[model samples]
Target: MTADMLIFFIFVLSIFLGFELISKVPSMLHTPLMSGTNAIHGIILLGGMLVLASAEGFIQHVAGFIAVVLGSANVFGGFMVTDRMLQMFKRKK
Candidate 1:
């Protein structure tokens, strides 16, 4: 009923929904999904920077830093994975 509890419930529900949805996706669609998620991660990275810019307290700053780092790592890792997947289809010279 409280705001924190509502957020927690929504977070838990999203985890379940996301897992169910991803588990059902065809393998052929994953490359496109990875690309899409990378774009979202880039947005997350931008959001983190904005959070860092607006942060007034040490805890907020630390949270923002972690968010930015993780978002950046996710974006780069997604790109690497997508590249490797694409490479699998290339013919050797």
Candidate 2:
């Protein structure tokens, strides 16, 4: 198999594994899991930055820019949700 095809297969497998793992998480653990995933999503931002730097054409540039934007949004939203969840557990003075 070609390198690209191998990467694609791994990506598909990871998607399935990710879904299964997430689906099994208890509701009480979901916030912590999301918080962890948010840190992982930070890597997405780095990937986006790499793509943006290596972009060689208009289409590539646009796609890379979009990836950066979406990754940023996902990271931000995840942190916001996680923060809200943690706030619910805080002891009031």
Candidate 3:
């Protein structure tokens, strides 16, 4: 098989494993895990912004720009929800 095909197979396998693990996680672990995922999603937003800024062609630029905006909104919204969830667990002084 070609290198690209091999890589694709590996990627699919990894995704399957990831879903398997996610499905087995306890309910109580979901919040913390989601918070961590949101942080990673924020990094994705940054990468999307960089791509949008560096794109050359008009079509690519517009598409990348939309992706960046949507990604940023997702990151921000995720952080907001995660923050509120975390706050609920904090003890008052």
After superposition on all C-alphas, the RMSD of every candidate to the true structure, in Å, is: 5.6, 4.5, 4.0
Model 3: weakest 10-residue lDDT segment is: 36-45
What are the models' TM-scores?
A: 0.58, 0.61, 0.57
Model 2 over residues 24-92: C-alpha lDDT tens digits?
A: 776877767768687567669889989999999999999999999988887777788777877787887
Model 2 scores worst on lDDT over the 10 consecutive residues at 34-43
Comparing 1 with 2 on TM-score, the higher-scoring candidate is 2
Clashes of 2: 0
lDDT agreement of model 1 with the native: 0.80
Residue 47, model 1: lDDT of 83
Clashing pairs in 3: none
The TM-score obtained by model 1 is: 0.58
Task: Give the poorly placed runs of model 3, Cα more than 4 Å off.
Answer: 1-26
By lDDT rank, best first, the candidates go 2, 3, 1
Report lDDT (Cα) of residue 45, candidate 1: 78
Q: Tell me how candidate 2 scores on lDDT.
A: 0.84
